[model samples]
Target chain A: MSRLNIAPTKSNQLNLKRSLKMTSEGFALLEQKREILVMELMRLLDRVKVVQQELAQRRHKAYATLRKAASHNGYYHMRNIANGINYEHDVHSDTRVVAGIRIPTLSVKQGAFRSQYGFADTDSLVDQTMIDFLALLESAGKLAELETAVWLLARELKKTQRRVNALEHIFIPNYKDTLRYIGEVLEGKDLDSFFTMKMVKKRLAEAAEAAEAAEQAQLSDGDAPDTTP
Target chain B: MGFHIIGDADTVLGYRFAGLSGDVVETAEEARVAFKAAIANHRKGVLLITEAVEDMLADDVTAHRLSSKPPYLAVMQDIWGPRGKRRSLQELIYEAVGIRIVQDN
Candidate 1:
């Protein structure tokens, strides 16, 4: 019956050491990537805040203008006028890839509001109001487009950040420690072998010297044994 | 669960999800209708909206926020021009973590 042995060979030891070094190097690179990503994320966030505030103000102004227009014409009349106006709607959709992320795009046709009544009969104020409303709508549309981009980017950034953190704090450190442990163990084994070889050589030299001294004493005794002979 | 997306015609087209109901609302009234429908459906986990549409229906958005059954609403900006002006998850982190760093400068 053969018993199982579980000792790592020289080649396995070398490979382990190499792997550990590679993991540590990889971890260092990953750390740098994480830092850069975090910085980018921060900047993007600051811009988002600024944009959010601007959007809020713009929306408020647009709403105020719309409300004033509605009051002047009466809500029902304004609705009727808007209903009579012809608007042509067209939309185009596309996709763009950014940093391995696929983002959708839309191209919308800007609607032109044309009055059913003749321009001559229509009040200039109503026409101006319509134009203002359209402008506001366009602004709102643009803001929506911007917001969509911001939100999607934010989501992606968050996911990337999480991954970076995991690599930095957990995986890299564990691999590095394991590598260090293996190296230390190998170094210790080398030192122990060197000490054992020196001790063995010293013991053999002492034994040889003792044997020579004893041989010389015996030979001298034999040479001086003439009376006994 | 039903999801309603409100935005510009362009925005609505961009966010076409399989099970989501979408409305390309230019006016406040249409925005209101979409908002009501979103609230009624209650099954939507997320309400993806454009800032432009949110502007038109700020009041409705606020009302949804105050409601008990409000879904997770994510507002984003359009990415079209050079600057890439929009909201992102990174922005949320800055808001949540309160750490601000400027990388562009």
Candidate 2:
């Protein structure tokens, strides 16, 4: 891994160490969040699969009944009957948060079917189609809730994964490399200074000894001259 | 928040019979426009789209699905039938989690 382009200094090393600690902690937390998000996503996906299957079956049956109604009553007549339906159902949406993700839940309040069209004009098939489709509306709402939850959780999981990867692969490694580089540089500087101090001390000691020897030699020579006098 | 729909004519009429309000869109461009308009409505709690419309605007629909926004979008089968083959649950999971989970069942 490449080291950061920072001066190899004590302060820089300390800062890198601190940030590395923080990044690793964040990476751990993000990994935990990712796990939770994945679990939530899987659960939601499972529910979605079941609800989708149920909705598909319901829709198929409803459409089959609709096709039968249209064939029996003629397309234009069926369309008119459909237009005559006045039932108004209220769909309520509620949201709950999971790991900061808002998952929406939808509920359909089915009202009692009021037959607005005349009984003399339409067959029982039209009523059946209406009932089937109405039932489908509720299932559709459920499937919507599950599928949307799955999508939201999945998206969040992806984002968290990205952060975790960046920290583990890029950020943490870079900090370690820079810290090691700074440490090696500092240690090498200390060794070089210690060797230079040792060399200077030995040279100073040799000079002091030579000056003492020269002074003794001069004093001895003067004593010999006094004796001669 | 109320429920809204964007789909083909027959699907819209069917939902209309159930008393839910929706827009009938025929082409991909119209569906895209209708989808944008429907999402822009803050009062719309859930936006239902037929599978056919979803196929027409797959990218937009997926983008909305992954976005942390409301109204929530749900794709349902139209009167015609299921659109060919859809992405399996496994594929969806892999796309999101970046791992393939072997089903125990």
Candidate 3:
């Protein structure tokens, strides 16, 4: 009744079959992609955990050291020296692809160590705390990288899942139904052709039987002398 | 390009010695206000927040930290000492990655 069934031809059915095969293949590829992305996300998540732990440990250590520096040198004196020193951290990122998702890869570089203040002004504890903070900053850079990668891959995973669902739930089954419908229509046409041929053969046979009977009656009447009106 | 420090008066004052100037939020509402200002800052590349202020603005800080690209947020322990339970970061990690961790004493 609809254009979908209008053509019910072998070629059309073959075309649909090919399309179904292609869609199935595409669904499989997408599923594989999703699996790979999920794996990468998990690995990155583990890396992030390790980095977080390191960051926290370094933070507490740094704060403790800073506290020691403050107590040993007096708060005002420590602040005075801290205000004078400057440390610059540089960061740049490049894109890394995981399962076809581009995620950023960040690299942090801290400038050369410079204690602008006189060596006697800041205690060794203060110097140690600054180094620890630098370490914490480096770890923070790593966290940012992993977090971004995990989130980006997770986003791609969601998209791949949606496509897989559509192919599995809707497209494949609908194509199957159309294939069945077309097959039924084709079989019905074949049956109609067989019935038409049978009717035509039966009519021809009846006509030939009538001709033979007429010919036999003429022959018998001629041989037996005339009979009846 | 630089860092912003947000904490109580003492923490802010201490970090200012390191030349980090930021909002001093002593209350939850003030924490939210300070977070908005800190996030809107394009010049600052990192936010140094005292753990106490961070705990007060827990939900807001988490939202902003995850959503923003720059001004990488680093929660630092207050020189005064940690306040409350110190599981905020751990809990956030669990939420993000669903990993259950065992802390060593």
Candidate 4:
């Protein structure tokens, strides 16, 4: 079998070493990225779960209040009361950024509660009820928005999680295994070449010793006449 | 092309997407066909393929890494269980951002 020459030139060896180092660095970076994504995802998930639970509760309370008011005050009266409640001075909204995600902040204007039905003599149940209902409705809307946000965020989190897992478990491992294989092959070649060189040197030495011995034997065989003289 | 789901018969049927069809793609050949069709439709922005299908079509997926069009394929672990705790996405994030964010729980 023709022996394979495995001694790469200095430049090629340098390139290979550099590539191996680069691959290692790349793997490290991928690992770090996975960690960051997971942490962020987990944090967001916690917030999402809390919001989800709170939203559900708020929705339940709002439905219950609406039901109670309807049963006691009648649907027509509730509608009229809702119309007579002036929210023009009460509702407010603002925006804030959280981890690059924009979310709206809602607040109710203080001291703006008043009845449009001129029920000053009797406490205006309609006005109070309408305000409460509107507040609940606002909370419900916010909850719906939060639900959507949570679902979308969860989907994104899951996607990122999979990607991280892929790099960590599959891509990096495969690349590393291939690199190790190449390294082993190269090392094996080096050892084989070293052994071949050692054998060739030993053979050359043996050949020289044989040549010297043959010369000495020839001289001994021809020296009989010289010894008699 | 719209989003399509591929997995075991039961798994595929469990996925619900409006107007999207989920089909059980058992072999590499079937996955390749479905993947190509999803790409051709031009309307699909994402293709969620099962991890099993992904493993079968690994070569095909790698071959198309240079494409810049839509139908960005994403592999999901089987809903039944994870194949394994593969590389965390945190690693990819670190690759992009150069910081460790996912810590031990």
Candidate closest to the true structure, highest DockQ: 2
- Winner of 1 and 2 under lDDT: 2
Give DockQ: model 1: 0.09
Off by over 4 Å in 2: A221-224, A227-229, B88-90, B101-105
Clashing pairs in 2: none
TM-score of chain A of each: 0.61, 0.91, 0.75, 0.54
Candidate 2: tens digits of C-alpha lDDT, residues A1-229? 7999999988998999899999989989998898888888777767777887888788888888877877898877877776667655666777888888777777767767767788998889888888887878878778777777777777788889999899999999999999999999999989999999999998888888888888888888888899888
Q: Tell me the chain A TM-score of model 2.
A: 0.91
Better of 2 and 3 by lDDT: 2
The numbered model that scores best in TM-score is: 2
Q: Supply the TM-score for candidate 4.
A: 0.43
Candidate 3 regions with alpha-carbon error over 4 angstroms: A1-15, A67-82, A117-125, A200-229, B1-105
Candidate 3 per-residue lDDT over residues A56-136, each given as its tens digit:
787677667777877898888876776676655565656667776666676666655555678866678777766766666
Tens-digit lDDT track of model 1 for B28-103: 8887787677766644234666667667777777555434233436564532311235434455566534467688
Q: In angstroms, give how far residue A125 of model 4 lies from its true place.
A: 4.9
The TM-scores that each candidate's chain B achieves against the reference are 0.63, 0.82, 0.78, 0.70
What shift in Å separates residue A28 of candidate 1 from its native position after superposition? 5.9
Better of 1 and 4 by DockQ: 1
Question: Each prediction's Cα lDDT score?
Answer: 0.55, 0.80, 0.70, 0.51
Predicted candidate 4 versus true structure: per-residue lDDT over A1-229, tens digit per residue: 1222334444455555676577667667655654654565556456546654554464354445455655576766554444433333232434454434443333433334345565643243443444554443333334323332333333444555566676567655654555455566678889999999999999999999999899888888689678977
**Candidate number of the best lDDT:** 2
Instruction: Write the number of the candidate with greater DockQ, choosing between 1 and 2.
Output: 2
Q: Each candidate's TM vs. the true structure?
A: 0.53, 0.91, 0.65, 0.43
